[model samples]
Target: MSLTDDAHLPPGLALAWGAPAKSNRLGRKPTQSVEQIVDAALELADADGFAALSMPKLAQKIGLTANAIYRYVRSRDELLVLIGDAAWGAPPDRVADAPDWRAAAAIWTQAMVDRCDVHPWLCDLPIRGAPMTPNLLGWAEAILKVLTGAGLSPSEGLACALLLDGYARRIASARRDVRDSATTSVQPAAVTRFLEPRLQELGYSILASMMAGNEYSDEIHDADVTFGLDRILDGIDVLITQKRSSV
Candidate 1:
């Protein structure tokens, strides 16, 4: 369905598409635009995390009353959808001379990771449903095109796209978790020190050995993300190979 099709669009989705909510105006014209509200919301989320996006708080940041904020958004949930869509913006430009579908897919997935790095709050936003916003659907379309170009059926291509998208999100979420933990509580170094003495008694022999050898570091998380992403791509390669063989 088209992004602008409002025949049966959900209220939150309509808002994402800039559909003004039905408003009963009383006095003067509203001061803030939906774009302004979403921008302020993004700023607030970036500064204070997604949990800090209450209407009152957002209004305070935007220098508007809480009720005035509702003129642009129906509720926090709708506002979140708007913020997410705006933050995601547009997908990466398609590489005109990408050598293979795998290269194209890698570029697409890495772009998503880079986006999440910029807006780590994206990991905190709850997944209400599948991609409905223009940019999100665009990203999905790009990946699906790559997969289908590699010989997968549309259904298979969609499945593979979903797999890759999920993998990207998982890596982003994991990165967010590490970031949040570092800011809020005990640092990883301290945690490692605390756990080093107890690992043998706790029966985590491999973990204990790594800790004992001073092998744990932030780079390990980066390595894990690379390993997981490459492994998933490798599996997709097997599927693509089988599809070509059957043809």
Candidate 2:
């Protein structure tokens, strides 16, 4: 069975995929507003990595006691979910009216990457559950609509969404690393020295070669996102063509 079908997927993911609802109980009364807490947490995350985001630190930064913050969010993981959705909430207004589904998807992918560019810490958060919040669900719905027009099967559409998001997050991580190295004036050779061994192990020696000389220029501008999106769309286009020919 696919990993998507694994029993270990998070509860929210199961629910989003039409699994049984686990609970209907009401949540606790809020003392701190969700917006206030999320705004403070995002500030901390943008300044520091996610590891720096403990409940105590967030509380201190927000001028509240650590325990007081709990009235808003149950845990740091929950805060992460909020921040991820919030950062992605500002997806470009243009995605809905691109010239074609492929063009729309490419825009969608870049918008996601742009969010990560501002919130580098978001690149590290794990997507343990399916989307439940409005911002996240809206992005998902947008991608689903684009994919539906591309003629992907339901499962293909879902997988394409996951793959595009995953690529965007990975690019965000790479952007962070590249920026840090540049700020420190670390030599490309030094980066290659450390990463080359790992690259070799992964059989990505070609990437190691590119990193050695800074050959991977920033001229690419979201091209990583566009390239992966186009490849997926090309596959879907084949399916669309087949359906048309059969008619």
Candidate 3:
């Protein structure tokens, strides 16, 4: 009874949609619920960093043996995905009718960033494939819908989704690096101490020149998403105009 046999579905769309409710592993209910396990994992990550998350530690936290944890999650990576999806939760609500396409798109991007700020641990999820969870796919669908309505072709809509996701991940990676460094090192100001005097000796003039040669900022702040999304949408607007003209 695989969904694949249905002719109406896009290829692999059923699998990509997410796991079925009928296959929820009902009989295998552990002594501890999935919510308990994920909450324990997230708390551990928030306190001690992602590296501190181990099977034994998580099992101990949730009152289960290390081997027992595998019944619920096949691997550490899968557990990580669950944690990330949990951390992300539901997407923020947006107006049914945004004044314009770019406005609608910016709202979508900002909602993602807000989620990232709330659950910084989400930034650690590996960037390899479509999220195999309903909530995450819903978020992706919303983003793509915004682009498609903005006069982008299907391929262009997909490209926009990838590009926006790349931007979000880049920002998240910078934050993760800073947090990891602080956790592992004795020197609290390692990055700043290293860069401060170098800039002081050279001054803003040479710093500006060096920056021109290498464009990109390592800072993970609200502006990272806002400025980047605005610039990206501006480019998309130009493309939309061209697309309309060509038609």
Among all candidates shown, the one with the greatest lDDT: 1
Q: For this target, which candidate reaches the highest TM-score against the unseen true structure?
A: 1
Per-residue error for 85 in candidate 2, Å, reads: 1.4
Which residue pairs show collisions in model 3? none
At residue 119, what lDDT does model 2 achieve? 80
lDDT of 1 by residue, 160-245 (tens): 88888888887887777766666555566787878977987889999888977868665426667777788889999999899889
lDDT of 2 by residue, 189-212 (tens): 676688878987899878877876
In candidate 1, the residue pairs with backbone N, CA or C atoms under 3 Å apart (3 or more residues apart, or in different chains) clash, namely none
**TM-score preference between candidates 1 and 3, better one:** 1
The residue ranges of model 2 lying beyond 4 angstroms of the native Cα positions read 1-31, 183-229
Query: Would you estimate the TM-scores of all the predictions?
Result: 0.84, 0.71, 0.71
Model 1: how far residue 1 lies from native, Å: 14
Indicate the worst ten consecutive residues by lDDT in candidate 2.
15-24
Q: What local lDDT score does residue 212 receive in model 1, on the 0 to 100 scale?
A: 72
